[model samples]
Target: MDVARDRGAVAIDRDECKGCGLCVEACPPRVLRLSAELNRYGYHPAEYLGSGCTACGICYYVCPEPGGITVLRRQVA
Candidate 1:
């Protein structure tokens, strides 16, 4: 199996997410997806694909909920 190198990371606050797919659509690397499992509010929240994020912040900017998505850029040595 092939895997992408970890370029960045994304944290999605499921509680804050309202199932809006803006982040999923805006993600450049197409790493974001809406989970089938429902959250506490019974909404499908966005989840990271575990890799391929570019730390572009498009997901963070597109997310309607404040603090819903947090992008962390991998530090280069």
Candidate 2:
């Protein structure tokens, strides 16, 4: 299996997630998923699936909570 090491990155705030699965469903690359572990709020937070984040901001846009998903877009120069 191929996993992205650091090409693209996304930061998920576990504490703020409500396990709505919106971000996961909105992710075009399918890089986000509900973590098996629970967060402080006892919800299955969205987690980065290794790599493959395109930084499209779909997850961020769909996320109901602010700052829930932070997308670090790959720099192209």
Model 1, 14-60: lDDT tens digits are: 98899989999988889999999999999999999988888888999
Q: Pairing residues by index, what is the TM-score of model 1?
A: 0.91
**Largest TM-score belongs to which candidate?**
1
Q: lDDT tens string, model 2, 1-77?
A: 25444456789989999899988888888888999999998999999987787677788899999888888866676
Per-candidate Cα lDDT values, in order, are: 0.89, 0.84
Candidate no. 2 TM-score: 0.86
Question: For model 1, what is the error of residue 37's alpha carbon versus the real structure, in angstroms, after optimal superposition?
Answer: 0.5
| Per-residue error (Å), model 2, residue 20 | 0.7
Candidate 2, 33: how far from true, in Å? 0.5
TM-score for all models, in order of appearance? 0.91, 0.86
